[model samples]
Target chain A: MPGTADEGFYELRLYVAGQTPKSVAAFANLKRICEEHLEGRYQIEIIDLLERPQLAKGDEIIAIPTLVRRLPEPIKKIIGDLSNTEKVLVGLQLKPHH
Target chain B: MQEKDDIQQEITSSMRNYSDIDPAPLEKAPTGIDGFDDITRGGLPRGRPTLVCGSAGCGKTLFGMEFLARGAAEFDEPGVFVAFEETPDELIRNAASVGFDLAALSAQGKLAIEHIYLERSEIEETGEYDLEALFIRLGYAVDQVGAKRIVLDTLEALFAALPNEFILRAELRRLFRWLKQRGLTAVITGERGAGTLTRHGLEEYVSDCVILLDVRMAEQVATRRLRIVKYRGSSHGSNEYPFLIDRGFTVLPITSVGLEHEASDERISTGIAQLDAMLEGKGLYRGSSVLLSGTAGSGKSSIAAHFAQASCARGERCLYFAFEESQQQILRNMRSIGVDLAACLEGGLLAFHNARPTQLGLEMHLALMYKTIRTFRPRMVIVDPISNFMSLGTQIEVRAMFTRLVDYLKTEGITAVFTSLTSGSAIDNLERTETEISSIIDAWLLLRDIETDGERNRAMYILKSRGMAHSNQIREFVLSERGIDLIEVYTGPEGVLTGSARLAREAQTREAQLDRTAQLELTRVRLEHKRHAIEAQVAALHAELAAEAAAFDTALKAEQGRDARFSEDRDRMATQRKKGPFAARQGKGE
Candidate 1:
């Protein structure tokens, strides 16, 4: 369950293929950032695309460890491991100044 | 198994159609190696693992490190290096010899080199254990440094640790997937074995891009080449491109086509007014290549230096690459002709790069030149006697290097002047040394020492000029205290004078002709002067006689008038006698 965002806040859905190291790291990194920055203002839907291959097309999952922001006015997607926090934050539109 | 079979069938069918169809567009990350991106058409596909496979000591590690170094240096992208074969120190030390400052780059937080120690005998595998530990380490390293590029040196070691080939294959596939998922441009190096591109045949399956490095001895000369065997979504150069690992790793893309850029039209003076006048109005067009071909001691270097001095005098930068002479020797030799190269050096207008052609291979020499040119950014470059490069490589190799060098110079819009040594005895055979360089050269000047009688007189002639008219006559050249001077040609019975034989014959013939012309002109002038004197005396005598005759006629008229008057007055007695006497006195006075 997730809280509803403000009129301008974003809703992010991080779709991972499996419980690989990169996936776990991406989940951890996203959760930590949400708690630190967007706290109580955003919704995160974590979908394991491997279990449901049909969802892969819904989010257009070409590779694993993909972050799809669904609830924003315009949808944004980023594909990579969540190692580079700054780039991820910038790509996700989660940071005000980058 | 069925899925595997289907995938194989799909691959085969794709291969059949792939040869004809254009490859899919690739998102490439620039490697920053010289001339490498041009061959790969930008660079390797970004975030896709590229496998770098080569035989032992074929510069696989060097290539990998260079890729990472370039990423850090050029793109400002941080990189991580995971080594299973060499320690971090060993890798750093090995790279330092080639001027790759890895440690300093690492210290600057741009690179992180990690050594993965794995003992094959100690690792015992039980059930299916995910390589999550290794992945976590790699992920943590990348995160700590925010790396965009990575290198896994010698992937074979990982396969060796795992006995089962099936497990190895699966693991390698997972590894590649992991790297791609991380969006890292990774270079995984592998050792090549007999009849295989890699040790486990896993590189072909796991890599999205495959680059093969080869070192082979052809005709007792070892040459290194790199070829892209497959790039999944990009069209890469198919030919084997030669490379060198000297001061830095440089890749020479030999097989590129299509040069449609227009060359510059401005002319640069060669510092010789007569020679400049001979070349149409001035000298070579700015950004045009000039070739000076001659035998030994034919003043080829002098001609090149004159061009350099001209460029330097105009406040333009010039680079003089002398392969035969040392810097000191070049300075001294140029000073003899009043070209103070040392002063130019002190003023930072002229740079001298001297190296022995035999000190390195042809590719190495070209790489050095490329690096120097890039760093110096000179407006003019002179290679004093490029023929010396023949001692280091075969004729074909030398020609290829020259072609690339010329092409590069043209592209950069740098005016280049190169001197080549030709044979003294044969004019037709001189082309053999330079091969087909004359075709690409904008201007070709041939210097020869024409031997006749007992004199060896130096002479220079313009063999060809692409867009302008040049002097057709052979100009005699002499080296004196001032400098190399072009003198007028003295045609004798033998032929145009050249060398000592021509000089001596010219001197003798000039003296004889001077003596004969002086005597003949002197005699003609003396006879003309004598004839003018006699004609003046006769004219003066004739004028005097005419004046006297006129006076006598006037006097007779006056006397007749007086006599008539006196006769009329005779009737009046002897009064007319006085008038007649006065008329006679007047006639006598006249």
Candidate 2:
């Protein structure tokens, strides 16, 4: 609430194992949620455990298609494909438009 | 992952009946370990997982590998070994020491070895994860070899690699269930924990059977032991059995109970004439237990050697167990007593088993006896001084061991003789035999040192003979250059006399008899002299009387001649003279 619109960019990472359909859908849903929530002030990184499986434990991921937010204050994790826009917006701490 | 999911679905659907609560009897596959099959009644439970846990170097991995190898080689059951700690090459090289040519078995498509790398740093359990890779690899290996047995060597490696305990526990349970579903008997090795069976407490997940291996050091010798902690529906040996890993694994159950051995009624000689005479003139019964208890230097071993010699002389095989002396020493000592066992040794009719009591455990000693007996198959056995085995174990343990051994010998119909060294001169205190095995002995001969007249004499008596009448007299026994000589002792009011005392008593009786004979001869000579003097007096008197008569006759004849010359005038004179002599005679008579 204290930072202005141009203060900072959102930080996020999508963890997946290979190119599974769930992982692909999770990436698309997460990107759409980021664009709708932060507009032009967001950055996203994608990790595939099939190639970089070592990074899975760093974010404490237990399931495939997990997204973690590394920003502002306390870190948070959201599992499964981010198809629920309302739940994703709230899980990312973004206010819905009136 | 999808392939694993598909297999899992299929396994779950088909394996719904293998519930944890099922109490039905399980099918077993033989482990092929000697003595193990007997104890387990078969082997491990088939189509179920067994947890083998132990500390490091306690033979966990080796046991698993041996089970797999033996299954492949002997039981004709192919096996898959999923090793987490050792590589395939390492396993192949190490397993060769146990005579398992895994490379050859693999080449035959009967054995499969898979190394599952579980590096904690590299293995990251992210998101929803199962051990899908392991399941797929294991399934592929099992199918590749059509294995009936599987082993996951050291499941602790997976416990270390996996960071989440909850996930690991869940996965282990599923893995065990899946192994059961696959209908393959499996073994999972785990490192022993501080207070629990496994480091990660994997015992809770393994359901069918749990086996524990322990390596304990007793008297600076490491002995490996195996015990079954739990078996679901089988009667297994509950005792900790001593096992040895040599060319193969051998587990020995120390004792078995049954008093059903047959007894023979035939009697055999004891080699000593006096000894056999005391034993109803025949000797001990065949397949009977005989105990010779004596004090030190009382010729117990001498009697034993004589028996051994006699047995060999009869063309029967004999085995002598010498705990105190070496073979050379026993043979040499027996030679001095005229019991020349050298011939029997040369002829292969006699054998000497010499070993120190402390060389191994009491169970191992019994096992050695069994093994030797199986190979030798001797008809006669002599345990020279069984008391020496007291140094090996407690009183109860020694009793139990001897009980089993004596029972085995009896069942084999082998005649056995044991010598026990007693302390002090009083021989009736049989508690010194160190074990309660005296009750089983068919014949007990007690030898004692009788101290009398400043000398110790060897005396032997039959204390008990079960089925025969035996001598009760205490015979003076002597170990001479000839052999054991048991002489009937002269028992007096004082006690039994031997050696110089007996000789002195015999000499005193001889001197008293000689003095009485001399006195009787002197009295007889005097009587003869008196009789001769009386006879001479009588003879002389008779001769004097005859002489007197002759003189009288001569005097009368001269008178008659003078009268005849003067016949005419002298006839009257002769008549007068005759008349005058007659008147003189009459006057004298008046």
Steric clashes per prediction: 11, 5
Q: For residue A46, give model 1's deviation from the true position in Å.
A: 31
Return the lDDT, model 2, position B186.
96
Q: What tier of docking accuracy does candidate 1 attain?
A: incorrect
Supply DockQ values for each candidate: 0.01, 0.05
Candidate 2 C-alpha lDDT tens digits along B445-520: 9888878789888889999999989989889888887988888887777677876676676677678788888888
Model 2 residue B352 lDDT score = 92
Q: Which stretches of candidate 1 lie over 4 Å from their true place?
A: A1-98, B1-25, B124-128, B256-259, B390-398, B433-435, B492-494, B498-590
Tens-digit lDDT track of model 1 for B430-511: 8665475777678898888777666666889998888897889889888765777887787767567665655577778789
In the order shown, what is each candidate's alpha-carbon RMSD?
17.6, 11.0
Judge candidate 2 against the unseen true structure and give its global Cα lDDT, from 0 to 1. Answer: 0.78
On lDDT, the leading prediction is: 2
For model 2, the stretches where C-alpha displacement exceeds 4 angstroms are: A1-98, B1-25, B65-74, B78-82, B86-118, B121-129, B136-146, B215-224, B244-247, B311-317, B340-351, B391-394, B425-430, B451-456, B499-590
Q: For candidate 1, what is the lDDT?
A: 0.76
